[model samples]
Target chain A: MKRNDFDFSQPNKQSYAAIVFLAYHFFRILVRQLWPVLIAVLVGRENLKNMLFWIIAGISVLVFVFAVISYLRYYFYIDNDELVVVKGIFKRSRTNIPFQRIQTINIEQSILHQLLQVAKLEVDTAGSKGTEFSFSALSMAKAEALRQVVLEQKSKILPLPQTSGVEKISGSELALQTILHLSFSELIRIGATQNHLRSLLIILAFFMTLYNQVEDIGVDTDQVVDQINEEVVYFGKIAIIILGLMSVLASFTFSLIRTIIRYYDFTLFRTNDGFKIVSGLFTKKQISAKDHKIQYISWADNPLKRLLGLYDVYLKQASSSEVRDTKSISIPGCNSKNVERIKFYYVSPEEWKDLKNFKISGKYIYVRVLYFGILPAIILGSLMLFTDFKIYSLLTALWPLLVYLAFRVNHKKWNFAINHELIYIRNGIFGNYFKALRLYKIQSMALRQSIYQRKHQLATITIYTASGNINIPYVHLDLAKDICNFVLFKIESDKRKWM
Target chain B: MEFLNEQIDVKGLPDITDIQAEKLAANYLKVIFITRGLTSFIFITGIVVAAILLKDISVTIRFSVAGLLIILFIWFFSLSSKVFNTRSYAIRQRDIIYTRGLLFKSTTIVPFNRIQHAEIVSGPIDRFYNLSSLKIFTAGGSQSDLSLPGLLSSDAARIKSFIISKTAQDEEE
Candidate 1:
């Protein structure tokens, strides 16, 4: 540490050590990726070329050394009013953030950082992407001490009570809440149904690619296909086994890497402002919002997870006018009991009581399942019938179609919602999500009557919240308008500050 | 900031007087009904789109869509004229009120301190008729954020200046 430059506000040694460790591992991974090219060049039977590869490797090593030096040299200081960071090579850049604008401070440590006994500090402000400032790798104790100091300084400038007059609970209570809500089974189910369908399809495509690669390298593609078609694959059993194993391993590796990167040691901590979420391994992320920033809260419980009483909750926060796209932050694997507790943080008990519980009308479920299944089947069947195909073509298509229809039916059966304290929606087949959002956060309301709906005297009332839009379909048109008017009246009449 | 303590205590918000409510609710129904014309124009465009998309449908379907479109157009025109002539305002000890709706009546009450910004806007239609709309913004995230619409330009200007002065005076305390 630079003793003279270092003041009481500077980070401790553990933080620097952690950053150095991170840089070391990252550099090592980079070198490993480039190793094969260097080995190929070295073994090309040209002495001069081999020497060039060695020189390049030497340069890479030098770069690694420089990266470490930079990480170690970087330092920051916190004054009463602002946080100043002095960092760079060749030219030092000093960045200052005012204390009053400080939104929240997050402390995060991944498994690697945990092993190193270091934690990272991130300071987030409104409208800033990621944290405005991050203090890399410090001892957890020192990180907490520094965090406390910063918080104290910030409070002096803002002078607002940390939690806006909410009850504060012990860490043990938080830990219990975390454990009760965090369901591993739900996470796995979520992993399965998630956008991973795209990945699963991609993985299947990758397998075909690998299969073609093997064929191009010498294996006979025609013989392999013929064997599978004829059910006579004795000649290439060993090769088939090897290929199957390779594909499985590759897919598993892809899934594992994706899951690790997206949700490595994800944690949520209750804070005075709201909940703080910390996740990520390589490029860590932290998000903090006050209760008022949240526009809607929703949750999902999948079929298998529902059996195990597992679900996930998400808070959709308002989009800043400066940025059009907004995202929802989720606390995955939450149990049913935690949903109410989480809602309690944002709404009063009386307001919570006003939320209406809505279940998918049986007629709607029938409509959804029929539309999802029969419509596609009819369209595909007609098109296929018009084209050249055998009698069994429809039957062959029936397999995936039937499976999808079953899933759709199951999904629609489970979707429901209510408007009481907040509007709560429960959706999904295997995993159930119960989400409740306060009405006051809605930016606009529209009662839309489609020609089909109008004939039925029904309309879809869409509540456009700051974050996103939610539509309650097939309600009586007059009732929808009445509800819309009621909501608009209440929203305009309220004097509460949302942000 | 201390000026807010003197203008009107915000703690008095919950109980609004009937006179204040009536004052704010004035011309609300007329303006709301008139705005239906604007909404009908928008809705008719959807009917035209449907007619084009579902061309292979029966004559009855086509006739129905066309009829709905024509009816909505007429409704829009009928309401448009009435909206301009309507106006209303209400006042409570803690807040001011405004209400506007046609068939479905809606009312809005804004506390004195809750006003973040206010604007008086006029378009070609309003300019021709000597009418303006007052849009008041608060910090909250509600879509019903706008308080009143369809006022005489002069009335809107007076309200804006009054609110501004009131805000300034409240801050002085």
Candidate 2:
């Protein structure tokens, strides 16, 4: 079908794929809520277990029927430039969203949705509560048309700057450029750099569930462990070394497989409207961000990635909530040049080198040392006298480590710089995280001081933007005041839309 | 939209420290004391009832709980006044500045152009004292949002309208 083939003027139901998805959704929730009862009935006598199977089958059929009914009742349409969704079996409550209020439109296609030739559509609105509405299934072409229409209607209503000689770029001015793309080799490098501990945790959790299932089927896992222990005793430390090597190998493999699959051929495109990211192998997720919607840009690097001069860039798009909006988009495996280009897209194109760097006061380490080092060490030292802690030796060794970490984090890792147009923050221990934002985009500024800091004439300045907050802590009180005043002046002097 | 970035000396800019801020109403203190007094009374009553109902518990624990509650009440009552006295807000020519907290002092500034909306809020207790609060929201989240409490209803209404007047002018264009 053509892009505009669907009848948007008339109310339409979601694609037929919704029936299966809605049923699966409801079934999962039902099983999650009633798993204890199901487990109890299964552990009972054979006759009751047999009856429980049939009862579950009946419930599945009932749930499927209810999903179909719910799908039939739901209706969505656009009228008077407002998107309206009416859905309820008995209550029949209706929601009306003005075009101007709609923030972002997201489309996602999982493997199942791909098989069904449909996609999930999400609409996030801007407000205090940030109400979100999602449709389980819609034809790809129709979803695109819907998003385009909503964006067009929204752009028309929202006022744009018409004061300067610069003509506003419309859809007609579309010029798509490949801002950044990851090749197979780069993807491999990125996959290799993926947090292996997280992958290992996932593998362990999977095995744990499998082991629980085997135990439920009456397997003697304790006997298996005892056998392993016997083998370990025979091999001595060699067995432990081998086991450690095997776990590391398995974790690396798992991380590589997951990262490759998730970001097989990720491409970031710079469109006239904004930036569009298309990636994923089995599940295709597309994120588009308009220039106006982006609040700030941040890039971070780990020690491993830092070795390869690699950074993962994130566009912190304006969103009331991250869970529902999917507004923030992260692109991994970007080189320094790629990061610079992306940063220039959101922030000013001036050189950030000449800006004077302001480090957080050395007094900042006092609280960190007091709370983390002295307090914990004192507590553990006092407790060591009355209690035997051979089993808690690991806990005993933690205080010194905490103290060192506090010193490393606050002493050398903090730097804040600001020019007339934008602000930059660089912080982190071992690896660095950098954030840059336009000054006019700032919403509010606050300077805070604790009793200790108040006595020391130090304050923390927090700048709130549409996306999130950025804090520069333990600066001189006069510097904080000057920063707040200057930032407020920037925001007040400019007449531009933050998002 | 206009290119208005011009270099200026930072020293010449208007300072926020010079502006005078208005203190909270006296009735606000009474409101806090009454609410805290009621809570303290309930706790004391519960302790007395539990002490009588469970005679196995020693007098030390019973009296300790009561004493702790009383001490906490006194501490909070004193802190409330200190916090109230410390709290003040100033409506500047281009922004609003509010300073709060007793121990951890904080000052917030919100430019008029950045404000999303202004709300007047009053609960049952606030109305009993003929007082209300004005909440100012920006594109920023709750952390940066401003709420000025312990104001006469008429005063709150006036400030809200003043903010709305400044913010609405930008919207109209």
Candidate 3:
């Protein structure tokens, strides 16, 4: 069918007007700051001659407000196999989305949506870079019903089962599964090692942005810098001590918030169609995977988690999002107890036996430490400290030394389960995680060796799944080859679509 | 479709074959000549105009910038030529192999079944030379996708159609 042939209508917003308003205001606030940015760039100072900057800023703000009004006025609909998006102030574009190619439809409601009783719909298709259709605000009930109807229509042509084959497992079993996987102490550790350095960098960047904004308004940045400098001298010793304490507190706070938001009373349940994952404390997120679409399962334990015996579990599916892959659930704090529960819950009991049989040896850990841990640390550290221009000179020496030792300890804790039915691997520090996947689901497998690895007779096996690749690093070359060959054999033998 | 053995048929996989570099080299040079002619013209004009207008700027900085441009031009030329000459793809009975690298050699193979689509693209220069580029898309990410430049237009078309037919037949089964 042609792109425009299908009839499209905007989904009715059952009663989410307030939520829409909230989202609108959020966007408006962001747009309001654009002028301050542009003026800062053009004038190179806060104040400009003839009040031109303010005039320009005022005009721009009016234009932005008009744009927001136009956007808020927009609505859309889908009917008779076509998606219709009605948007624009003067001229409207009623974009049509065909039902034939749609792969999946999901309804997501943020906290605002939940409070307002509205949800957003995301429609995805195979091979498409972005969603084919999206509705910002719709009634929750209508969204689900519409999603089902569209999904059913799409499934008729796409060849997947129309009905989700969710198996209903006992709530007690689910609670057991949750208990088996969740570890309170391990959660704290995972939060601690969450690579907050990136977040810290982002915070620093935000502070710089605020500083720039202040400067743009014609404030003397030199004055602010001087003020900071004066403060440092006025209370130099106290400032240093306070900074140290503040840094520690900030790190812990970051960890605590992340844990509370991500894993807060997370639970996994078995439904006829697939496994249902319910997580998040403030605004719960429920995700389900078709039994057939799951590509991999992984869990890992970070250094702290390892010390506390914690494990984080993740299910990698064919469809992925930023948070889906990143935010994993604590299967039950750092331990082997929940491993069996996870295997049996997702995989068959027979598969569970096979999973248990597969082992991770000490040799693998030693090789991982020698190559992945020590060697890279030394090289990176030396390179950073002894570089030609001496950038990151001090950080290079101190950071790597600490990182190397930490990684070494973490690598020694690495473990994997390679059975006839599934391949599971667990690694990571503070952010402990475990991933498991059916052998048949692996789309591709590769055995790679760097020149250095080759010299040491070490190889890294990367098993490709739909979500991403999972690597078992620094295994003996012989073991790597064997696993690679076995994976290839399994992948080829299975008639299931790994794609 | 069923298991031939309880293992991957490693014996069936093809070994890497050396591809002819002349076609690639010729295309690379033509592209380089066109790009250099346009960019150098722009750069020279910019330098002359800027030198005349910006009297406060030192002559040394301008000359140094010009030198930097020359170095960049040489680097781009060398890099492109090396990449063009080294990159070549081969097709086996069941899979297509692409070999490329200036420093670290990489050979990637995609089986016929895995190919999502194949396209034949001919630019103005390529049309002039009766050559086209063939891109083989797979379900995998961009890195695993294969591109073969500087093929005879007819050959590229023939291969494209062949792959399409093969894929259609497999899917129908």
Model 3 lDDT, residue A434, Cα: 62
Model 2, residue A471: displacement in angstroms?
A: 1.2
* Tens digit per residue, CA lDDT, model 1, A110-158: 6677677787787766554433667767777766665666666665555
Q: What is the interface RMSD of candidate 2, in Å?
A: 2.7
Q: Rank candidates by DockQ, best first.
A: 2, 3, 1
Each model's lDDT = 0.59, 0.81, 0.60
Candidate 3 regions with alpha-carbon error over 4 angstroms? A1-30, A33-83, A99-104, A110-115, A124-126, A130-133, A161-199, A262-265, A319-339, A349-434, A437-465, A470-493, B1-88, B122-128
Per-candidate TM-scores read: 0.58, 0.87, 0.70
Q: Could you tell me the interface RMSD of model 1?
A: 9.1
Candidate 1 CAPRI category: incorrect
Q: Give DockQ for candidates 1 onward, in order.
A: 0.06, 0.54, 0.11
Query: Given the true complex, what DockQ would model 1 score?
Result: 0.06
Per-residue alpha-carbon lDDT of model 2 for A218-326, expressed as tens digits?
A: 7799999899999999999999999999999999999888888889779998875578888888888877887777788889998899889999988888777332453
Runs in model 2 lying further than 4 Å from the true structure:
A1-3, A45-53, A128-130, A159-173, A196-254, A321-327, A351-354, A390-409, B36-73
Per residue, candidate 2 scores C-alpha lDDT tens digits across B55-169 of 6779888778767876776677667667778989999978999999987899899998889888989978889999998999887777788998889999999988888898888
In candidate 2, position A94 carries an lDDT of: 87
What lDDT does model 3 reach?
A: 0.60
The residue pairs found clashing in candidate 2 are none
The residue-level lDDT of candidate 1 at A60 comes to 65
The CA root-mean-square deviation of candidate 2, after full C-alpha superposition on the true structure, stands at 4.3
RMSD for all candidates, in order, please.
10.5, 4.3, 7.9
